[model samples]
Target: MIYLDSAATSLQKPPAVARACSYAISHYASPGRGGHKPAMDAAAAAFACREAAARLFQVPKPEQVVFTNNATHGLNIAIKALVRPGGTVVISGYEHNAVTRPLHAIPDVTVRVAAGQLFRPEETVEAFRKALTPEVTAAVFTHVSNVFGMILPIQELARLCRERGVPFILDASQSAGCLPVHLEELGAAFIAMPGHKGLYGPQGTGLLLCGQTPPPLLEGGTGSESIRQEMPDFLPDRLEAGTHNIAGVAGLLEGLRFVEKQGVQSIGSHERALTVQMGEALAQLPGVEVFRSKDPSQQAGVLSFRVSGMDCEELGEALGRRDIALRSGLHCAPLAHRTAGTLETGTVRASVSAFNVPQEIPRFVRELRQILSEKP
Candidate 1:
């Protein structure tokens, strides 16, 4: 099977990740739950994973990194803490439901989309600058579009938010391990990411790096200050409640090690090369419409496209029957589909990963062409 949907979850993980998880399951215990040897070892293992995450993302403090169930869990905590009632929050047009739905749930919160033409970062920054009014309490931006893989100018947007004294929250779900993310350099109030995507960890593992401590999303045992009725005011313990996912974090540590050794720049270059090759081939095929950045440099590994005569679901099903894994439909980002003019007929998305090879692109294109050639 050829897996092409790394954006949803990385199906190809390093062998070390699996090994680490297996080892943890048998030997590790719940972190911070007890003072015994297994519990202490588990706590230490979790802390080491936190440190690894902090180093990879350039987070200033290790404790500032809090683990969550997934990117959505982390995003919810950041949004709920930063966005003020009746205040405006500026976001990119390409944000997933993870960002949009949370904002919608907030009472009296005004959402202003900084709409930008696909692959045009300058226009995106300009639109955001114009929308930064005094009434804006916070600004949230996705580092890259999951649908189109168009990279947003996050540094410029961060600077603009700083100038306006608005707290900057970054959704790095698609960009975390795929691109270089310097938390200190970006100066974002919060950055959320999933361990299962670019990080190559198992599902149900995520991290939220805090520039400033936010209020705890849940109140419960943090394995610290058990007697106190209030949640601890410390860094990670304040946000991380309940038992830790020791096995998941153990796998995440190995994944982080693999990424650090391979380097993000190298991984990104490889993925983008595959995307370019696949996108170019698809564009040349009859009746195929590719949705991506015109400039190859402005895109990541994700490519969205559609065949003229076929529905996206039909095409996806055809490809699936041949053991090709990709995503179809709106991709949980309707705003992105609207921006790309694919709202009515959702596009098929093929996102590459480091494990994917150049040879796979031609095979995929050939299969897609054959599928499209068939009469409905």
Candidate 2:
């Protein structure tokens, strides 16, 4: 099967990731649970993963990194901690439900959407500037759109938030291991990402890097403050509740190692080249509308498009029959579809990964053209 949906979850993980998980399952115990050798070894492995993540993201301290189930979980914790009651919260139009749903749950908080023109960075910045009034208590945005791969001007937005004294929260779910994310340079209040995407880890692992200590989302045994009912005041322990996902962390450690060794810039260049090829080919196809940047360098590895006579779901089914894996429909970002004027008919998303080859691109295009030419 040709897998092209890396944006959903990286199906092609490094061999070391699986190996580490297998080893941890047999030999390791719960971290910080006991002083036994097994537990101690597990604790060390978990801490090493934290340190590796810190170094990769340019985080100032290792302890500030908190592990969670996925990017959605991390975003919930960050949004809950940063957003003030009865205040305005600014966000981009391309945010997933992970960012929008949490804000919806908060009472009396007004959400202002800064919807820029699709693939236009200058318009996005202007929209953000207009929405970031003094009443806005915090700003949350995605570094790259999951639906269109539109790269937002995060550095400029960060600078604007800094000048306005608004806490900036970034959702790096799509851009974490695929692009260069310097936490120190961005100066965001909280950065949330999943290990399963570009990091090439298992699906259950994620990270949230905090600039300041936020209130705990879940309170339970952190193994540090057993005597007290209240959660610990420290970083990871404060947010981390219950037993650690030792096997998941072990796999994530290996994944981070792979990313570091490969280098983000090199990986990004390779992915962008694939994106350019796919986008250009799709645009040239008769009756195909590709939703992405005219300049492919400004985009990531995602390409969303639709055929003139075919429903997105029908096209996806046809591709699936051919053993081609890709995503179709709204892609969990309706606001993005609305911005791109594709709300009525969602686009077919073909996302590439490092494991994908240039040979697959032409085959995919050929098959897609055949599918589109068929009578409904």
Candidate 3:
């Protein structure tokens, strides 16, 4: 089957990822829990994984890389750490519920949406500039839009936050392994990413890069500071409670190595090329509303569109029958759909990964053409 739903989770992964997970699960013990060889091995693997992630993302040290269940978990940590009740937080209009819902749950919090048109970086940055007041407690933004693959001007946005003294939290769920995210350069208070998505690791694995100390979300056995009533004031121990996932860490380490070996720029270029191939052809179809940018640099590896007189899910079902795997609907970011003006009937999203070849785009376009005809 042709898999194009990588923005959600990468179906294709390096062989080493699975092998590492299997080996670790069978042979490892709880990290830092015991003095046995298995426990020592787990500790080494966990630390190595931290070092790898820290180096890849240009973080200052390995300790700052904290593992969580997913990006949502890390985002929760960042939001809960920096944001207080009744404080104001600024966010992008294209944020997924992962970012919006947490803020909504906060009591009396004011949210300023930096609403911008798709592929319009200047406008998005301008909107953010207007929203980021000195009084705002923090600003949260996603590096890329999962639905449309629009790459926000995060550098400018980050700069704006720094100048305004606003703590910045980044959701790198869609950009982590697909694009370069220099944590040191961005200097965000926290950056969250799921290993399953662009990192090509197993699900339930995530990384949270920290620029500042994070408050503990869960406090339990951290294999250190035992018999202490309060959580250790360190980074990982403070945030990571309970036994670590040795298997997931092994898989994630291999995934991180694969990403580092291939290089983010190379992978991103290949994915963007496939996206452009799909977008340019789909835009020509009569009655098809394809969201594309004249400048390829404005978008990443996702192409979103819908045919007239057809619901996006219906189109997706037809493609599913044809053995083309993709997703349709809001992609869990209804705010993005509303901003793109595709909320009434959501757009079908085709997200490419590094493993997708040049040949797959034409086949997808051909299949889409077939589906459009039946709908018409």
Candidate 4:
């Protein structure tokens, strides 16, 4: 099968990731839960995983890295920690439901969307500049759109937040392993990413990088402060209040190491090259509508398009039956579709990964064309 849904979750992982997970599952116990060799090894492995993530993301200290079930879990923690009740919060138009839902649940909070044109970074910056007023309490922005793969002007938006003293939270769910994300350089108060996407880890693994003390999403025994009723107020132990997913952490550690070894820029380039190849071919097919940027620098590896008179999900189902795996519909980010004016009919999303070969693009395009031709 030809897998092209890395934006949702990477199906092609480095062999080491699976091996590391299997090894940990068999030999390791919960970190800090006991005094046995298994527990000790688990604790050591968790810290080492943090160190690997720190080195790759340029996080100053390993303690700043907090592991959670997935990017949504990390995002919820960050959003709650930063946003206050009845305060105005600014967000980009391309945020996933992981972000919007939490904000909606908050009482009396005003959500002002900086709805910029797709693939227009300058327009995005301007939109943010206008929305990021002194009264705005904080800002949340996605590093890349899952639907359109439009790379937001994060640095500029971050600068805007800094100038106005608004706390910035980066939803790096799509850009974490696909681009260079220096914690200190960006100066974001919080950054969240899933380990399962470009990081190539298994599902149910994610990281939240903190620049300051964040309120715990849950309060429970951290195994460090057994005597205290209150949770410990440290970097990781404060946020992490449950048993460690030792096996998942081992897999994620290998994934981080793989990204570092291959280099983020190198992997991103490979994926984007595949994107360009597929995009060029798709643009040639009659009755196909391609969503892309004239400036390739403003885009990433994801391609969104639609065929005339074809339902996006129907097309996706057809492609799936042909053994070509991709995603369709809103991708849980309806804000992105509304912003891009594709809310009525969501586009087909084919997101490339580092493991995809150049030769695969032609076959995909050919299959896509055949599918369209078969369409009534």
- Candidate 2 TM-score, C-alpha based: 0.99
Q: Give Cα distance to truth, residue 274, candidate 2, Å.
A: 0.3
Please report, as a residue range, the 10-residue window in candidate 1 with the lowest summed lDDT: 367-376
Off by over 4 Å in 2: none
lDDT of 3 by residue, 11-59 (tens): 9999999999999999999998999999999999999999999999999
Regions more than 4 Å wrong, model 4: none
Candidate lDDT scores, in order, read 0.92, 0.92, 0.92, 0.92
lDDT for 226 in candidate 2 is 91
> How far off is residue 112 in model 2, in Å?
0.5
lDDT measured at residue 50 in model 4 versus the true structure, 0 to 100:
96
